[model samples]
Structure formats: C-alpha cells, structure tokens
Target chain A: MNARLYSVVFTFVLTTIFVLCLAGINALASGTIEKNEQLEFQRSLVYVFNIAEDIDSISDEKILSLYGNRIEEITGDQTVYVVNKDGSKELAFAVQSPGLWGTITALVAFNEGGTKITGIDFVSHSETPGLGGRIDEVLFKEQFRGERISSDPSARVAVVSGQDTDSKEDARVDAITGATRTSESVQILLNKAINSVLPVVREVVE
Target chain B: MAESKKTVFLANIWKNNPVIVQILGICSALAVTNNLTNTLIMGVGLIFVTAFSSLTISALRRMIPKNVRMMVQVLIIATYVIILDIVLKAYLPSISKALGPYVGLIITNCIIMGRAEAFAQSHGSVLSFLDGVSAGIGYSLVLLAVAFIRELLGFGTVFGVRVMPGGFTPWVIMIMAPSAFFILGAIIWIARTPIVKKK
Candidate 1:
C-alpha cells in the first residue's frame, strides 16, 4: 500500500513539473508565434491576389513592405484585404468552412468587377498531409484564377478529377488525384463562398 | 557493461542500428519518406528530441522512484517534443506547416521510449546523449535513402528541383504510402545483407 501510494504521488508531481515547463515555454513564445501566423496570413493574401508574381521567392522583409505598401485591410461583416492589380482594386476575403477532417479556411479573391476570380489561397486546413492537403499547392489554386462567376451565379466552377463534357462553358478545375473527400469539401466551400460571400464582396468593391 | 564511449556511439550508428537492426521508428520511416526535405526535418527533430530526452532521463534516473520511472521518462520526453514544436512554429513557420501534425506525431514514436528504457536508464548522461544522437543519424540515413528513391520516381525531382529529362514520365505509385513500404523493405534488405555477411 505504501509503495503504491508513493508511485501515485511520484507520477503526479513529475507530470505537474513537466507540464509547467511546457506551459512556461509556450507563454514565452506566444507573441512571436502570433506574429509569424499573422505574417503567413498576409503573405497568403499577397499570393492569392497575385500581387507578387513569385510568392515563394519573396523575402520576409519584402513581404512585409509589399503588404504595407499595397494591401488595404477592412472589416465590416467579415474581414477583407484589398490590393490594386492591373488598374483597379482586387479584394480577397477569408472563407471558413468545413473540410473532410476539420475546418478549412481559404482566402478567395475576386477582380474589381467581382465576376472573375483573381486567385485563391488556403490560410489553414485540417486534412490529410499528402492527399487532401494538396489544395494549397499552386496547381490547384492556379485553376481559380481568371475564372468568371456571374452576378446571378447559376453555374460556377466545377472540380472534376475526370472529364467534363458540357455544352456551356463551365469553369472546371481538376481535382487532386487521391484526395476525393478534400476535393469535394473544396467544391462545397467554393459554392458557399460564391452564393453567400460574393454578394457582400461585390457590394463592398463596387 | 563498462562500454567505451566510441564503441557505444558506433554500435548505435551501425551494428546495433535503431531502424535497420532493432526495426524501431518505422512509423516515421514510412510516413515522412515521400520527400527528401520533410524527411530531413523530421530526422533532425527526432535527433533533437532523443538526445535531450536521453540526457534528461539519465540525469534524473537516480532520483526517480522505481515504480514510476516509465511515467517520468514519458513526461520528460513529451516536454521536449512540445518545446521543439513551439520553436518550429515560431521561427520556421513554413517548414512547421509543411510538417503539420508530424511534429506532434513524434511523441508516439517508439524510438524515444526504447532508448529511454534501454540505454538512458542504465547509462550516464553524456553517453546516453551520444547514443541517442547516433541512433537518430542511423535512422536518418535509411529515411533519406528511401526518400531519395520516392521523390525521384514520384516527381522526377530532387529537393523540389527538376532533375529528370522533360520527356520522362513520373511514376504515380511512388507518391503514395505503399511505395515507401516497398522502398523501405528494399533498403532494409540491402543494409542487412552487408551486416549478415560480416557476421
């Protein structure tokens, strides 16, 4: 009985100390961590709007300066980031929606007229690493660029792994090979962003 | 077992190698071997955790109660893993994001627990740290070999740079988890053949 009770007490004390150590480190590093996350989000916005041609090669200092100089941040019903591209202002907003494993947050951008998609970027997602997670890759996001979305918007972009033999010109993007669930989730979120978010974005831009 | 430091380190690196011989840490070996860069990062992270945890466990071995020793070792190991995760997130966010849940997945890796129980519990701090580091390097060598084949075949690229001829086609099978199983099996077979012959 004595040894058993001692084991319990020993484990309790050891666990407490170790957890405290982790908590202390996390507390100290939280500020820098928050700053890095914000920087990544800003960088994603720049990439999504195609403000910087090569988002992968840009330096951290360059990203900060470019964001400061070009991008405008505004919040009303939802937070939005705007950048001037070609001639007029282009707006990109964060879309939080459900994914296969967990919440998927994507930043989608539209041209000044709100009829064509400028580009899209994933801010965060909880999906399988190699398979579903390819949504963040350049090939997937590249498909969204320059695709038209009507103001009334009956037919929008369709993500298909196979062929799309349609009569009308539907903006079709290729789904990732192995990640069918993630591709479907992305399709659902894209439609949601169109039906719900696009109207407010159009009103704000125009 | 009054072992020399040189013998101890060399044993973990080759003869008593963790991955090839003991067949430990195969979970990460399979999971992160698809690309060279992620595997390198995972290897370095494992080294950092293993070395420090071994050092810590060995240092505290005398003080820990015999009945609760495993629990204490786990606590020490987990603390270090969380610290590594925090450091990665703060300074190297892109790599951290690329690694994703794999950073947290290091906790469940059997290599750390194995070393803690086998070497650190009986050995001195510095020798245990050396053992941990060498074991990690051994694991890394095998992972890098597997990743080399996987990345080359999967994308016809090395470290994200195009290496293969423009006309060459990439094999899609190399991009998936099952490919790693095959490549790793081959690696173990080749690596062990040498040791078996020497014996």
Candidate 2:
C-alpha cells in the first residue's frame, strides 16, 4: 500500500472505531441521563412550590411523590406548575433571562394573589461558577421565599448589590459580591418576568 | 531505550511538573480551583483521560503514520474525555452540573497532548500511562493547594463545611479567577526558586 494511502486509511479506520464506541456508550447511558434530568426538573418544581421541607436532604422518591401528588402541569405558551396550598392556588413557571455567559432559567413561584413570590429555584444557568453562579446557593434563593412584588411592574424584585435585605417583604435580594454584571442581569430578568410574563400567566390561570 | 518507571513518574510530578515546570493545563487549574470539591473532580477526570490516552497512543505509536500521529492522538484523547463525561452525567449528576463545560474542555487541556508528543510517542504503554497519571497528579497537587486557600478565605469553608466562626468575613477576591492568577503565580515562583538557584 502507498504510504499516503495508508495514512488516510489508518486515520479513517481509527475515527470510525472510536466514534462507534462513543455511540454505544452514549446509547447505554442516555436513559439514565434522561431520567436524572427529569428527576432534577421534578425536584426543582417541588422546591419552588415549597411543598416539602429539608429539600436538600429529601430523597428522590419523596420528590417524585410530592411532584406527582401536589403539582398540576399546565402546558401552553409557557408551562406552569400549579399547587393548591390551603385552598388557594399558587402557580410556578420557568422563566429565562440573559446572564453573564448565557441564558439563566429559573423556576419562580408566586403567592395565591400574585402580589408576592413564594419561592425561587434556579433550574439551569451558564453563569461563571463561584461568582455569578452563586445564584444557585441556598443563601441567595432563600431570600425570594416571601418577597413582595412591586405593583409598578417596572421593578418587581430588585437584586441590589451591597444592600441589606433584612426583611422578606422588602422585595429585594443582595447580589453576589464581585459579580456586578450578573447581578444587573438578574435585575433585568426579574423586571422582564414581572412586567410581561406574570400578568399573562395570571390571566390564564384565572 | 525505555526510561525507568519511577524516574518517569517522579519527574513529571516535580522536576517536570506540568503546571509549574512545563506550564501546560494552567487554564483548568485557574478555572476550577475556587472550590476543593470541583477541583478534585476535575483532577480525577484529567487523570483518567491522560492515562488512557497515553496508554492507547503508546500502544499505537508504531502503527500510526508519522504524518498523522497528532490527529490520531487527539482522536484517542477526545474519545476518553467523552466517556468520562457520559459516566459523570449518569452517576454524579450534581457534580456534573457543578463542573459544567470544564469536563468537555478536558480535551483541550494540552497536558495529554504534551505527554503524547514528548513521552508517549517513544515509550512503552505502561511507562506512558505512568507518565500521564503523574503529570495529572502534579497538576492536581498545585490546584488543590490553590483551592484550599481560595475556599478557606473566600467561603470560610473547607469542602463546603463552614470552618471559620460565624463572624469571620470571607475574602471576596479569593472567590474570583484573578485570585487564582496571583496564587498560582506565587506557587510557581516558590516551587521553582530552589531549582533555579541550584542550576
């Protein structure tokens, strides 16, 4: 065989074998990966709804059960998860906004009257970890549990940096230090969600 | 013609340390060192990729045409990295999420390719594997040291456990990438000062 031809043949043959092996491995694990994602989304829904306690320690089975029993899925322009709390209906929906690197997807829940936020959980984000990504930390998300939404709609929830957020009803959360751009992005995202998405979803639920 | 296994392994760890000596794979070292847990996982992932890729490259060195050896080495390295990624996603979803794109970026780390070109191309499979693993260990040792300081001061924690008292205020700069630059530079200077003096 010609040396050049041999080089081409060897490279082609090696690539085929490796790709086939990767395909086989991916096929084997795709099911489990999908299940993990589904379970994670269910976990986020459960967390945002605040239906169960000790979310981090809560078992996967418990999350699934809580999601299955208490949540109602309404699919439309925006998918909403509704859970009835003490005879009043609370609604949660996934919202997307631009972040430092890419889109930030958050599951945000509203109180029965939509006047205050019940809870918030970050579903997915591409922010830089340890800085912008601190949004996923319990310390940050926990502040949204009972924050009131401003009626002006221009700024429903404020993510102010270096500010004291002592009260839940203040409708403000302190941004991660040294992450000014990401903090600003979060504020913009909240305003968009409040001004555009919330009223439309509220009408649909009603 | 083959180098002794101990010399090959130990040299990569200190004498020719990938991060400090060769200066390869500094990108991931800086990116993942803000936290201990993430840095550890990244280290393990690199070790697995490098070791397997080196072994495979060494075994196929004779068969791979000289003109296409680099391409063949990359293909092998990328395959191992993809396998590591798939396995992480299936078994350790949360850590997988934490590491994010860094896992996939392992293919471009340069340490594996450096091993393939400088050592694996001429070495036997076992020795090449040892070289790859030691290089990874050397890289990990430096990264973990940096992470220890960063996580301690930045988060007032070690491996996510709150070690400092409640009133301890964390150092905000330690949580960012520029801090890694300063720490890694200091580490390189301290590790190399003796070597430079002896020479």
Candidate 3:
C-alpha cells in the first residue's frame, strides 16, 4: 500500500475506534456525574443556610433531609434560600463576582433584618489551590459569620491582612496569608453584594 | 532478543527511571508536585494511562503501519486518559476539581508516548505492559518525593495535616514554582549517584 493511503486508512480507523470508546464512556458516566454535581450543590446550600454542622461527614441522604426540612428555595431575578431559626426567618442569596482567575459564586446568608451576615460559603471558584483557593477554607468563611453590615450604603464585610480589632461593628475579617488578590476580590464582592443584592432581597422579603 | 519479564518490570523504577535517568515526563513532575494528594492522583492516573495504552498498542503492533504508528499510539493513549478524566468526575468530583488541567494534560505526557514507541511497538503485549507500569511508578515516586518536601516546608503539613510543630513558620518559596526546580534538582542528584557509580 502507498504511504499516503496507508496513513489515511490507519489514522481514520484508529480515530473512529477511540472516538467511539470515549462516546460510550461519556454516555455511561454523564448521569452519575450530573447527580454528584447536584448533590454537591445541595450540600453547599445546607452549609450556607447553617442548617447542618460538619457537612463534610454528612451523607447525601442527610444533606437532602436537612436542606428540605430547614431551607425553602424561592426563584426570581436571583434565587434565595430561606432558613427559619427560632421563629425568625433568615435568607441566603448567591453572590457572583470576578475572582483572580474566574468568577467566584458565594452563598451569603443574612439575618431576618438583613443587617447581619449569618453565614458565608463559596460554592464555586477557580482560584489556585493552596494560595487563592484557601478562600473556601472554613476559617476564612467563618470570618463573615455573625458580622453586621452597617446601615451606610458603602459599608460591607472586609477581609484584612491582619487581625481586625473592631470585632463588633468593623465587619473586617482576617485574609489568607498569601492570597491578596483573592482576598481583595472577596472584599469587593462583599461590598457589591451588600450594595446591590441586599436591597433586592429586602424587597423580596418585605 | 527478549529480556526477562522481571528485569523489564524493575527497569523503569530504578535502573532506567523515566524521571531520573531518561527524564521523559518532567512537565508534570514540576507542575503537580506541590501537594501530596495532587501528586498521588496524578501518579495513579499516569500509571493507568501508560499501562493500558501500552497494552493496547502492543496488542495491535502488527497491524499498525510504520507510517502511522505514532498516530495510533496517541489515539490509544488519549482514549484512556479521557476515560480516567470522566471516571474521576463521576466518582470523585473533589479530586477531579483539584487536578483541573493536569488531567487533560496527561494526553501529552511523553512517558506514555516514549514507552509505546520504544518498547510496546517492538515487544509483546505482556512485556510492554510491565514497562509501562514501571515507568509510571518511577515517575510517581519522583513526584511524590518532591511533593513531600514542598508540602511539608511550604504548608507545614502533609496531606493537609499539621505535621510541623507550633513554632514552625511556613516557607513561602516552597509553595511556589521555583521550589519545584530546587527540589527536583536535589532529588535527581541524590537518586542518580548510585546509578552512575554502577557504570
């Protein structure tokens, strides 16, 4: 066989086989992968709503029950997940802002008055794993917990390099040691969310 | 002249290690060796890709024309890598997310291509599979060693556990790219001393 003809036939046959195999594998695994993704999203919702503690050990069944029992999903211009605690209602809303590498989506929960942040959880981000990615760490997320957002329009929760002294009204949280860019992005996102998303959510609640 | 299966299998781990001696797959050696967990996942993925790709290529060695041998080997390898990626996504989404680009980049890992061309194309299926497995092991060991030091000094932990004492301060350099070069260099120097003395 001529070199050209043999090359064409050989490559054509090999490509067909490999493609068919990949297609089969993708088809078989797509459903399970989608389910896992959905489950992970549910876990994030439960975490942000403070419905469950130690979510890492919580199974899919546990997350579903906790989420279903405590959180109610309201869809509109932005989806809000509501949590009722001690006869008062708290609302969790998703915040989308550009990060160092890609967009970071965090679910931020507010008290019934929308004055204090009850919880924060970064659902998705593309920051560098040990550096900027530490934004997802529990310590970092905990900084925003129980932080009050002042009535001033420009005020929001902030991540500082060192300790924040005004633990009561400062609304400042310590940032990751080596992740300045991600920290700054988070701060900006917090202010943006406080300014814009809060009012819309307030109207929804009222 | 066929070599013994034992020698063929052990060759890649020490005698002619793909990382230390032949130096085939260094790109990933530097990229994913910052953390122990990422290094382990990348190592296992490489081992799986190399072993199966080698086996498939060797089995079809006779039918593959000389003009398109490289093309066939790559196709087989790419198929295996895609399968690994999909499986990781389905079963272990967290690890899959951590690996990110390194998973897709396995298709271009020279170790798989080098083994397929040098050993799998000439040897029988069984021998080729052994060579592939050993090569991956060699690469994995080198990567894990580098990651151990990087993670320990850089993060004061191993696999995210705080192994370092309370007084220890983390080295910022260890977590960055430059640390990989220094660690990889020192590892090669230490690993190659005995290999060179034998000659």
Candidate 4:
C-alpha cells in the first residue's frame, strides 16, 4: 500500500472511532445536561424573585403551582424570559450585554411601575476572574435590589466610584473598586433592560 | 521496569512540570484561578483529559501511520475533552457553568498536545497514562499555588471564605490576568533554581 493511501485510511478510521465514542458519550450525558440547565434556569428565576431557600427543595410541581403560568416567551425576542408577577405591576427578564471581556447575561426583576429594581442575578459572564468578575458577587448585586430608577427620561442609573450609595432608593451604586468597566457595562445593561424590554412586558401584563 | 515507570511519572511532577517548566497550558491557569473552587474543577478536568487521551493514543500508536499520526492524536485528545465537558455539565453543572468555554478550550491546551506528541507517541499505554497524569498533576499544583495567592490577595478569601480581617484592602491587580503572569513567572523562577543549579 502507498504510504499516503495508508495514512488516509488510518486517519479516517481513527477519526470515525473517535467521533463514534464522543457521540455515544454525548448521547448518554445530553439528557442529564439538559435537565441541569432547566433546573439552573429555574433556580436563577427563583433567586431573582428573592425566593432564598433551597431551589431544589422547591419541587417542579411547586414551581408550576407558583409562577409556571407566569412564564411567557415574547414572539420575536428569545433572549427575554419574562416572569409575570401578577398583572403589569412587576416582571423579570433575562438581559445580555457585552462585559469587559465577553458577554454578561443577567436576570433583572423590576417593579410593576417600572421605576425600581426588585432584584438581579448574573446568569453568565466572561469577565476577568477575581477582578471585573466580582460584579457577580452577591454583595454587589444586592445593592441593586429595590433601587429606584429615575422617572425622568434625562436621568440614567449612574455607577459611580467612591460614592456613598447605601440608600437603595438613590438610583445609583458605588461601583466595585477597580471594576469600573464591568460596573459601567452593568449600568448600561440595566438601562437597556428598563427602556426596551420593560415597556413590552408592561403591555403584555397590563 | 518498575523503576522506569516511577521515573517517568515523577519526572513530569517536578523536573518537567507542564506549567512552570514547560509552560504548556497557562491560558486556563490565568482564566480560572481567580477562585479556588473553579481552579480545582479545572485542574481535575485537565487531569482526566490528559490521562485518558494519553492512554488511548498510546494504545493505538502502533497501528497509526507516521504520516497522519499528529492528526489522529489530536482527534483522540479532542474526543476525551468533549467527554469531560459533557460529564461535568451533567454531573457538576455549577462548576461547568463556572468553567464555561474554558472546558472547550482544553482541546487547544498545549500541555495535552505536548504530552501526546512527546510521551504517548513513543511509549506504552500504561506508562504514557502515568506520564499524562503526572503532567496534569504538575500543572494543577502550580495553578493552585497561583490561585491561592490571587484569591487571597484579590478577594481576601480562600475558596470563597473570608479570611482577611477587616480593614485588609484587596489588591485589585491580583485578580487580573497580568497578576497570574507575574505569579507564574516567580513560581517558574523558584521552581527552576534547583534544576539549573544541578546542571
């Protein structure tokens, strides 16, 4: 056999064997991975709503009993996962925005009047670990809870450095020290979430 | 024979460490070392991929044609990495999520490729597997050391538990990739001093 022909046959055989093995493993694990994703999403939803107990302890049956019907998919936008909190008074949705390194996807919950943040949770981010990534810290996220957005269109939530923002009603947050870019990105994402998604959600719920 | 196996295994852990000495897989070291928990998972995942892929490639080396051996080696390595990714996602979703694209990036890790090319291609399956495991362990040890310093200085925590007393200001630079470079350079310098002196 020619060396080149032998190499081709050998490569083909090796690739087929490798692919078959990976496909088998993937098939076996896919169901479990899907279930885990669904559970994680549900858990994040629960967290954004401030349902602090063990999400696993709350059964799927219970979730269905609580906010299962409240979950609705917008026709054109798949990025938004809206959870209606009865009428048009409160809602939560997932938003994605570019972070310092990559995309930061977060779940932001807002009051029915669209004038305040009820809660927030980072769904995913690719920010630098330990630095900008600290934006995902619970302490940082907790600051957004009950933060009132200024009703004036000219006003935007400001993420300022070295500011005293202990008051959640102030519509401002002290940026995580040294993570100004990530904090700024979060502020931009918050504004986009409020301006674009909230009105659509308000219409559907109201 | 037993002595040779031991030598091959021990060599990678110290004299030929994949991180400090060889500097093969430093990308994930910088990316995942911010937190101890994520670093631990990443280390374990790398160990599994390197060990199993080495075993598989070494087992098939005899029949693999020289002309296409590198291609075959990569295919085998990629398969094991994907398997690791899937398993982690299924069994350890939180860690998997934390790891994110880093797991897929394992396929591109030069350590795995270097081991396949240098050790596994010429060695018997069992010996190559040991070599791979040792190399992975070597990488993990250095990464954990780096992660320890980074997490402590950056977050004032170890494995997410606050250890520093109040008023201890965290060093912002310690959490960034540049810090990993400095820490890793210092580690490599310290680790290589004795090796260089012996020569």
In terms of lDDT, the best-performing candidate is: 2
Classified by CAPRI criteria, candidate 1 counts as medium
Per-model TM-score on C-alpha atoms: 0.93, 0.93, 0.91, 0.86
Predicted candidate 1 versus true structure: per-residue lDDT over B1-199, tens digit per residue: 6798999888888898888999999998988888899999999999999999999999988878897888788888888999999999998887898888889989888989999999999999999999889888888888899999999999999989989999989997898899998998887888899899999
Report how large a share of the reference interface contacts model 3 reproduces: 0.91
Model 3 Cα lDDT, one tens digit per residue, B1-199:
5599888878889989999998878888988888999999999999999999999999999889887788788789989999999999999899998888889999999999999989999999988898899899999999999999999999899998999999999998898888999989998999899999999
lDDT (CA) per prediction: 0.86, 0.91, 0.88, 0.82
Error of 4 at A179 (Å): 4.4
True contacts kept of each: 0.75, 0.94, 0.91, 0.97
- Model 4 Cα lDDT, one tens digit per residue, B76-128: 88888888888889998878878888999999999999999998998899999
Clashing pairs for predicted structure model 3, backbone only? none
lDDT of 2 by residue, B55-145 (tens): 9999999999999988899899999999999999999999999889999999999999999999999989999999899989998999999
Positional deviation of residue A59's Cα in model 2 after best superposition, in angstroms: 1.7
* Candidate 4 ranges beyond 4 A from true positions: A53-89, A98-103, A162-164, A177-181, B1-3, B161-169
Evaluate every candidate with DockQ and list the scores.
0.69, 0.83, 0.73, 0.73
Candidate 2 segments exceeding 4 Å error: A161-170
**What is the TM-score of chain A, computed separately for every candidate?**
0.89, 0.95, 0.92, 0.84
* Per-residue lDDT over A1-206 for candidate 1, one digit per residue giving the tens place of the 0 to 100 score: 58888788878888888888888999999999999998998898889878786888898898999899999888888887888766788888989889999999999998787677789898999888778988988888887888766444443677777776242235777888889989888878888888889788778766
